[model samples]
Target: MDINIERLKSTLMELSKFGYREDDKGIYRPGFSEADFAARKWLMSIAEQEGFITRMDGVGNVIIEYHAEDVAPDTPAVMIGSHLDSVPAGGMFDGTLGVIAGLECIRTLKAQNIKLAKPIWVIGTSEEEGRFGGMIGAQALTGKLTPHQILTSHDPDGIMLSDAMRSQGLEPMEALSARLNPNLIDSFFELHIEQGPVLDQTGVQIGVVEGISGVFKWIVKLIGKADHAGTAPMEMRSDAFMGLADFAYQINRIIAEDGTDTTRITVGKAELKPGFAHTIAGEVDFTIVARDMDETVMENLAASCRKALSAIARKHKLMFEYEQVSWLTPMKCTPSIVEFIAQQAQKLKLNYQVMPSGAGHDSQFFTDITDTGLIFIPSINGISHAPDEWSHWHDVQAGTELLYQCVLTKAVNKN
Candidate 1:
């Protein structure tokens, strides 16, 4: 209630304009795209208009800061923000909500004329949709991203990550040095949508995130000789498609039998080469993505995929190989910060629960550099990264208020 709900809505509306789509009502703000840069400029303009300092790091991460007149320059800042880019035809609330909610927190603090010992910074990160297979901004900020990864990565469409950064007037190597001083940021807080059914299904308003799932991805290929569909005998032909089918069936069995219920396996992309109505397919390129809250589970899932696919290739007389594209270990939220969020939800008398995130987030990377925590509001049907992905206005308001309270709790010096 103390937070400005109207301002929150208006900010989100403004950001949405940068990449609005009329077809499916989704957004297409791909990282380092012109629209994404426009959104970054819009955020900086707002910061400047509000008398806040603004800067864009080498990796295209946007930072807007509010400095107390008496605070020491060496004092660590408390940060609240999320990424600005979205997936192709992605929803509005996925990444933009956290950044907007953070801006509103700054506005609310200014309205009350409160000054903390430390600074408040709102960050708009880049490339967080795994376009390059990992979050570049947060990892760059903590100096965790390697030069090899940044230079060689590409999107599903075959767009080079380095080229994208170069087009935006940024250098990928410079991003490697985008590390923040360890003493400069004391803690980080991110308020995001649950992007799952747990909260909405259980009728909970607030979710104090306990951990984020680890993500492992592989790019696999199955190779075989194309043969005439009419001439090749069914028993004698070495079919590439058959190998793919066998892998798919065994993946299900692997997870159901060897993996836990929380484990997930997805073959989200597949391409068939030399398509012909009567010709047998010669080759296949597909991606494998597995997720779980435990790294061991993710490792086991990868092992299972390799073993099953290798056997299928041998049995079907096809060739198979895979590349481990990327890996992110699960991260646990800071205990004190998690407790702070719970206390605020209790104070507000809002229904809440402690939960783990099923998706990867920037908060997971922040854990390496500083104390980090996450706040989640319910998604309407546990849907995200799509046109219909939505969160209720009431839930948004409650989550923003909780974010405001949590920031104030650590931002003010106790001396």
Candidate 2:
């Protein structure tokens, strides 16, 4: 059955208002913020009003499920959704689209009086914007969360995760209780905006994601003596910023030698200590985030980065140190599910591409636990995480329709 794009659009627009700002016309629902929590509660309330069974998990994931009378007990459920939270000043469609699309799928099924052999659950996962470590809700549901992470995690502002949870009336350690038995879930599906230029540039209507890239983050420090900018001889002074600049310049060469076409390395954050126009920078602290789909390539890239930094430090007469913050191995979507999604796309007469997602998503966490599929619609100008991020309504409908078709096939009894 086809999805109602108008209904989906209306719900999306209504949800966007929860964190919208007039200043920049952006949404500010960082994970576990007041806006994020309000959006979750609103979703649960809306689902309940529509005659669906809805509840919020301990970690704040909003679940709306459909279990008809004919569906047998102990049957596995088809869980479909994405995270509900967004980056600060993020666009409206980033993670919210997946959650809302899943909701629309359920609505369409109910309106058509479709009978189910299995239960279908639409979840709006919490804290996926990395304010206190991203994909918190998904990690909890898939049994990937650790008590250490829950207690020690903090945002960029130094607010602890436990404190954030308690502020929202949720106990910290209780997140562990949100995990579900792997067997209890039949499969998972997520429909999301491509958030990149590939599909949009290629004029493809759908993207059947094959895998997600592995990522590693490093916090690097380069230390040197602070000296008077004018008096310090250019040859004698040890400049930390020079070391950092040299490393940045080597990134392209590193990738060309040790990385693939898909490999990406970014120095996203940086700081110079003893900031003054008359003083040379005494220290430079920067972050290195690298991504690649292959584990070995990730290893090679990391090694090259370390080598480059060591050489740069020696050349600049600076001390070098780095901490490996986090490393997530690449994950592949279920082969069967990937093929199934492409086959369904062909049946729908939609142009499709099988590609890897450069960005992380909640579905990556479910790869080992159940069959998982991720559908992607084009993002206008390959933009996301900003107010300008957008996907056309027709693309949204097509992606949602594909999700619905897959869910119907899996949730309905074939007998």
**Which numbered prediction scores highest in lDDT against the true structure?**
2
TM-score of each: 0.95, 0.93
Tens digits of per-residue lDDT, candidate 1, 112-164, equal: 88878889999999888877886889889887889888888887667889999
Off by over 4 Å in 1: 229-231, 276-278
Model 1: ten consecutive residues of lowest lDDT:
406-415
Clashes of each: 0, 0
lDDT of 2 by residue, 322-384 (tens): 877567778999999999999888888889999999988899899989999999999999999
lDDT of each: 0.88, 0.90
- RMSD to native, candidate 2: 2.2
User: Model 2 reaches what TM-score against the true structure?
Assistant: 0.93
User: lDDT (0-100) at residue 388 of candidate 2?
Assistant: 93
Pairs in clash, predicted candidate 1: none
